[model samples]
Target: MNQTIVPDSQARGLLARLPATPRALALLARFDRPIGWWLLFWPGAWAVALAGGGVVRWALIGWLLLGAIAMRGAGCVFNDIVDRDLDAKVARTAARPLASGAMAVKVAWAWLLALCLIGLIVLLQLHLYAQVVALASLALVAAYPFMKRITGWPQIWLGLVFSWAALVGWSEVAGSLTLPGLLLYAGTIFWVVGYDTIYAMQDREDDALIGIGSSALSMGRHVRMGVMLCYLAALGLWGGALWVVRPQILALAALLPIAVHLGWQVITLKEDGIDPLAKFRSNRFAGLLVFCACIVVGNA
Candidate 1:
């Protein structure tokens, strides 16, 4: 019997129309899944918007979008390279180009370099302080693929890696990090932890068998509550970020929409089947809600 490989539902779309090798390479980089970039882009957008640069620094937002796409793709490619063997053991990840042997490791490395080149262009567009802050994340990014092997809370490292854009965006717009930026970064970290934990639920059994750690497995039966707490913490920190900028009681209300949306996720969360994946992907919209709030508060 042949091993049947399964990919996540989001793995289809435009990339499906490409030639075999290129398609495989695109899958390796997760280009078909725009949500990854969207989630990565939002915290940076939140920072830019909250710094009152939503209109004045429109070009910077554009640059952050490009950087997010490139960097997120690069991260996925690097992760696939590192986890190819481990990926083969997970049903949802087993069809990944590297895991399935559809792409060579060397070719994947080249693709990773190509994505980094695009990231480098975006980096050059940032100011010195933001550039240094951004460079510091490379070490974190490099360390992330191994965290699952050593710790159950790998999502914490991912939060640190993914929320880094908040620092870069704040530094670029405000010329340095401050209370608002730090709070935004901290809040975004909890947001990442919440969503990634939902994502991890899909692989719990495989992760257990493979002897890897994940927040989903660690939270166990309390996964929904765990996610709820993470979301609550994210809102609190984000609310603080808004308060630091505007200081009005009404400013704190800016977070209400995202707060409601996150609450909906927890209330509707189901630990089985595709529910976790759906909730995980819903954060893209949640990110937008927060961005809108940032715009309202920052521009007010």
Candidate 2:
């Protein structure tokens, strides 16, 4: 039952082949993990589809995609910089560039600044209203790294931070937020909370030892149930969002597949053998499914 990806020898071989600075920097940014961008991009897409009447906005979408990539990297770098000591103690994150001393803190901060500058450039392409909504997320992003230290619901904070793009996207398309947009944003928050809590489960043991807080620890023996509730709430809110936009039976029908898929995830989830990273990564597909539902309902 060697279910672990990148076995010890393979991991060692991969590390040996990696170049010094650039490769380490890429790893730190998690360029290898496209899931981050996918997660980030979805909220933007959701907003565009809902607000733009399901017509894709290619230019805005492209810019938002780039912004997501850069900002997610910046966020990761900042988190790593702040959590270097804690990352060093965690088996899964011990090899991170900051934690392993492959990159200096000052260098990491400089990299973060560069990425944020790029993100800001992308942000400026949007309307002034969208710009304000986008910039307002900075405080949430700033406070997120410290959340695990203070509350067992750090994933909740992460949901707020990660899904802020929904508001930005809606504002970019509509020039202002609407009730539908707000509902979509709320749904996305619950979605993030559910998936990220699943992700936190992978480091639950280490997190507990080091005094970190996560929904995984809070749920304790009922982690699966907690995830189910979170997922259900997400679905309910998304359905509500769609209802606000279009009250037809077809609009509700569009969500059925997504609901079934989420149910499958809940039923098939192996809480004991759960690989949090994989579970977290799986959310990209979940997001896509819901995005498709939104597009269909909105277009109809």
Candidate 3:
């Protein structure tokens, strides 16, 4: 009896050799973008930490993580599918799987359904109140794609959709909503608006050409100042949330790092640079920094 052991590299190679379309489909789901998952996970984590220090609910965290990945992907895919035609017209989005025709609409829809099913499983794990909070986000999610077509401030809509997890997270842990949770949700919204505006700057030219609306285009030459003000608003709301939760000076102090990070991002941002995408991606770290502040204050 001969037994063979496969090396890790060889196993990976074999897997890589398999048909890659499904893998590509997963990528289109934004599985590759950990930023989305992180953004979704932090709010829930903050709520759990701030809910007076019970045993950290690892199972709930795990479920929320899974839900975030699935739902964020579903949202992105839906956005891409809806904007497939418009995406093809934009330089930055032209190579997207849907826009490039690498994936069929039917196939994308199937993938969307699969992701939504995963989200449903996660939702079922939540308390009834949390479930209701989660379900209420459906309208925001459904309407998000159309905002860029109709309004120059679609970042505001994205804020509402993306930061909704703050509410869900708080409700999950506390079994009810509070002023702190609502303020955190609002703060997260402004943060999303600020960072996403930075993300949108990369496409300002294409957006202008294609007649798509974004804060980037709306602010135009004043983009930097606009982003700065948005960042300030985020900080203010976050500070307010901290005050409501802990009412401590340390909570306010914890915000200093995040404030500096936001300042650095705005001061160093180069809208005309050759690598706006890299700059935009850096906001993942910014989000992480702010989240760290939230966790520190919440856990303290």
Shift of residue 175 alpha carbon in model 2, Å: 1.7
Candidate 2 lDDT score relative to the true structure: 0.82
* Candidate 2 regions with alpha-carbon error over 4 angstroms: 1-18, 273-275
Judge candidate 3 at residue 298 and give its lDDT: 72
lDDT-wise, the better of 1 and 2 is 1
Q: Best by lDDT, which number?
A: 1
RMSD after CA superposition, every candidate:
1.8, 3.6, 6.4
Q: Can you tell me which runs of candidate 3 are displaced by over 4 Å?
A: 1-18, 53-55, 273-275
Candidate 2's displacement at residue 157, Å, is: 0.3
User: For each candidate, what TM-score against the reference?
Assistant: 0.97, 0.93, 0.90
For 1-300, candidate 3 gives per-residue lDDT tens digits of: 111111111233333444567545755676655676777666766666556432467677778778889999899889988998998787666666788777779999999999999999999999899999999999999999999999999999999998888898889887899898898888888888888888888778889988989998999889889989988998998899888888989889988988998888889888863444555566677766766776777777
RMSD of 3: 6.4
Shift in Å, residue 90, candidate 3: 1.2
